[model samples]
Target: TVIEQYEFCRVHRKEEIIISYKIEKGYPLHIDFTILPNWIKSLKDELLKIIKGQQYSEYHVDAPGYYGTKGLAIILKTLTEMFVQSKILTTNLCIPQLLSQYLAQVLVPKTAIRLIAEDFNNIFLDMAKKIIID
Candidate 1:
């Protein structure tokens, strides 16, 4: 079947972000994204609020991390899976990113996406703990 016909690979890089999907006709659709530092900073700030208990949302979190809802642990595998006030602020938004409120032009796989989100969230949690929350 279709699922049996194709393979998947994950890619990460500094210049650009890419997500590829295989179509039924055996072709692949490619999506590319550029997330600037300011955008990343804005997202970090949003997560910072949550880490310091300045934010609250539904009780459930995405996966196997004690990160809980303490930060960007919002149980969303894709950026488009926005939970509530959750969003990534940026000046550049493609149509799909705009629709999903996700910074990426395409969907990220389950755990990988959440892991990246948590990694960013943890940055503020780990470094500027007292200045932000206190």
Candidate 2:
């Protein structure tokens, strides 16, 4: 369902990162990086840790659980950090706009929302607070 609803495209060129999402029935959303932010550049080690720490198999399994949502929240949180550190306005962000479409569609079904919400609570709310407080 998530795959059906959203499509992701990523490209790494020389020193730039470009990530885009194509939502069904919605225009494409892009997160283009012409230059790396200092904060992101400094987090090379942390980024490696994040990538290395994931349980990749859980992402591939066809199950109704929090794994997918956890992954999504991680991306969202990372994007949030990027925007904040770059001093970019939230209005320019694209993931939230793309995600809003998916959320709207999921609301109609309501079956998967619980797991998503659980993961959101754990990864986005709780972890974010801890990171900020610390």
Candidate 3:
């Protein structure tokens, strides 16, 4: 019998992000991903809509002093996640640092990040379908 395994990992730093993947035999492999809450996905969609300038009437109001740029939603969301996950000694909320890091890493080149996210979704869907079929 033949057994194969695959492993993936990512390292983050101020300079650059590094990703590694390897395949081996005999040894077991495990993958772990932080499951983002559904609220985050909804927020991302809302931010995307605003950035695309498809705001509805409810979102038309302006604050006391601001351009009402759609980009603010993303910025707020990032900060919220950071503050919640960080859980500093002084703060009560437990910010998720890993998610913050992942988002920061992807947002460097926005267009490229979007394309890569789309590709990852498609590939994962294909893999899911294969799993169902077999």
* Candidate 2 RMSD computed on C-alpha atoms after optimal superposition onto the true structure: 19.0
lDDT of candidate 3 over 3-100, digit per residue (tens): 22222222233113211211221111332113222323434553344333364212111120110123334433543553334442112211332434
Ranking by TM-score: 1, 2, 3
What is the clash count of model 1? Answer: 1
| lDDT (CA) per prediction | 0.32, 0.32, 0.30
Q: How many Å off is the CA of 5 in candidate 2?
A: 36
Best by the TM-score measure: 1
Tell me which residue pairs clash in candidate 3.
84-94, 84-95, 85-94, 85-95, 85-96, 86-95
lDDT of 2 by residue, 2-91 (tens): 764443322234113311222331221332222223323344443333333331111222222222344344433444454344544233
Higher-ranked by TM-score: 2 or 3? 2
Model 2 spans with C-alpha error above 4 angstroms: 1-67, 92-134
Quote the positional error of residue 126 for candidate 1 in Å.
28
Of 1 and 2, the candidate ranking higher by TM-score: 1
The candidate, 1 or 3, that scores higher on lDDT is: 1
Worst ten-residue run, lDDT, model 2? Answer: 55-64
- Over 4 Å off, model 1: 1-30, 33-38, 59-134
